[model samples]
Target: MEISTKVQIVTKTTTYHPPLAISSFPSVPLITPFARPANCGGIYARDPGDILVIDEQPESSSCYPPGFATDESSFFSPGLACPSGYWSACMESTGVNTITTVTCCPIYRSDVSLSCVDPATLAGVWKSQFCTFIPARSVPVPVTRSSNGRTSTTTSTLVNPGGINAFGIRMVYQSSDVVTASSSSSSSSPSSSTAANLGPDSAGGSGLSTGGTIAIAVVIPVAVIAAIIGFFLLRKSRRARAAQPAALPAQIEENPHKPSPYYDYKPIFAAHQYHGGELPTNQASAELPASSESPVELPAEAQRHEMR
Candidate 1:
């Protein structure tokens, strides 16, 4: 089912208003809004002519980001002013010894149009009214116990012999031209020698480097093994070289069963070569001296053969 309703349109006379004036601000008052004291979506603001106004306020969490914290750095330097859209805010941190005040941006409405004022500059502004500052508080010094297990409430002031200069570096001075320890009667040469010999360069070194030690340990054995192998090889070569000369004069042994090679050669006479006419026919024996090829002459051999 459809129900018909009447629609009405009304027109007003031409009214003069400043350029860029809001439809309901600095000129006309908006009708009763759903929320009380609401002129805009956020907190109370100021009008040009001392009239109460309202404008958009950023979320409280926006001030916690790192970007806003950097802009709020204006809190550190009193002379520095906040950037065009940023406003300085003070944050308090309670420490064990003291409370620290950190400056930060209160409203993080960077993308949107909003008003930001310095709390120091504006004494009675709405921005200052909403923001509160922490007062300076005094802190007591901590009590420390001595090594002897004794505790005391009293404190002692420490004096700095080497005072810091404008650059925050401690000033150093040469106490005396000569060392005081040298004047002592006792000899300190042994201790100085020990300190100097502690490391390759100086006693300040913790110890020899592990890599160098390991390299030395590995190289020494390898060098020893290589030396030992070289020594044995050289010894074997010398023995082999010595044996070559002795082997050069070696002679081949002659066969013992064969007749001596030093014997004189004589051809045996044939039966036709024997002269039977001069002697008895068919003479069977002709004796010769024994051992004709012997190196030494026989003392009294000349054995006679039997006649056939």
Candidate 2:
């Protein structure tokens, strides 16, 4: 069996701004690279109240102040300003010399209906005491495009106005889009018998791999346990050996005649019996001879008598 999938995405972008009152002027040829005229002719002044009305044209003989010049005329000055009716101004410097070029633009006033004046009419009415006539303001237009697989829209506007000499205005906008295709495989073929054989082989291979890992894990722990047991046994045996008494030298047997606490002793004598005036057969006896002389004489007399 086989399966497939697809995805789609979309995005949008929008931008808005307060409309600009004046357009950008064309580039002009001048000694200073940053010097340019305004998009329209209008009076520029240091003080807001000094801005004159555009009801009548001034004469051609009019001359500006010592340090001021018309919007179309090029002159050197340290600073510039927009009059009461003008709402914005900008100044840029080349840094080659200390001279700065100033440009000014008319305000988008709902209260007044003053149209842009011609350069000749402006020259005829030029006054140095009032403000100088400089260049107009530069405003950006929004552009939108949608083609191929992409779409984009951009809008811009000046946000902050600091002063005549500073570029304080900021521009901001937003954009968004889509992407689809991904790098992933789909499915497999429809061969049931082939898949069955392959499945067994794959399962066997996985089983073998798992078996090896399990064997290694079990064997390592068992070996460690055995080693620990053996170490304990060896230590116990050493302690037992240290606790046993040392072997003594050989001893000789003691003499039997010597007095000792283990044996007792007594004195021995022979037994004898006594008889009165007789000796044993192993003794010799002696005879007595008392009236010897008298007896012998008597016996001799008697024998003589008998013989007679």
Candidate 3:
């Protein structure tokens, strides 16, 4: 059966407003924890064992073999952890000063131009955009002595025009190793084919050999005996269960002497009944009665006599 009733419907319209947002960006830069040495116009010197960024798109730019690099330059710093980036060329530099392995960048990754406060403070000595220190060289000029008319000359190497005396730096590249492996695949000899039985010796794979056959022969009997023993044990257990009587439900005997978790009650006074004004007392402990023990006599009129 179905019942129908008339009803009125109502709808309401509503409007929504977007929320206001406040955006901000921090000006601080992220710097590595490594210590920086100050000298060349606040520009840091290249440190040893620095990981260089890799330019992966061009394989030749990476730590490839000498033949694969651009201009056939040998890969430098083969001990570096990662692939050498844009600069992959290697060199055998002969100089008394050390050739530091390094890469330069602004303190913050966001700053691509490598411009910063310390590096910017030095105008000519430090290249802010490139983030490098311009080392100086001392070329010997004619020096005249005041006491004696004698001329002397001394030479010192430093940075000159077109990055001449800039401190030498080398980038570390990933070590490239070559390995050769030959698979034991039977080759279709150009000399012999199906017409001639003289074919290249086929490589032996994990085929069933004498040892494997012996192992299978030894394992089958042991497996069969184990299965038979397991079946018999299972059947014996079933028979034992069928012969046994159903076990009775265990009786949950509660502890009658279990102490109350809360506390022990007034054992003697609560259990025994006493007349009015005759309070219970502990005679052994010499404790006085809690109430007055004086007995009061009832009037003759209040006394009633009843025969049972």
CA lDDT, every model vs. true structure: 0.29, 0.29, 0.27
Tens-digit lDDT string for candidate 1 (1-308): 99999999895543322111112112221111111121222222223322122221222323121112112222221111222122323333334222223222223122222222344554333332323222133322222323355534333221222110000000111111012212331243322111111121221222222223545799999999999999999999999999987742343234444433345333445454745557646767789868857498766778877999
lDDT, candidate 2, residue 223? Answer: 100
Going through the candidates in the order shown, the clash numbers are 0, 7, 8
Q: Provide the lowest-lDDT 10-residue window in model 3.
A: 174-183
- lDDT (10s digit) by residue, model 2, range 1-308: 88877777774432211111111221221111121123223222222332232211222312212323333444322111222223223334345233334333333323221222223444332431122222244433232333465646454332233111111111111110000000111121111000011111121111122123445799999999999999999999998997664322111133555443334443332122335765555546877857656544345455444554
Question: Which pairs of residues collide in candidate 1?
Answer: none
Worst 10 residues of 2 by lDDT: 173-182
- Candidate 2, residue 200: the lDDT equals 15
Report the poorest 10 consecutive residues by lDDT, candidate 1.
163-172
TM-score (C-alpha) between model 2 and the true structure: 0.16
Estimate the TM-score of every prediction: 0.18, 0.16, 0.17
Return whichever of 1 and 2 wins on TM-score. 1
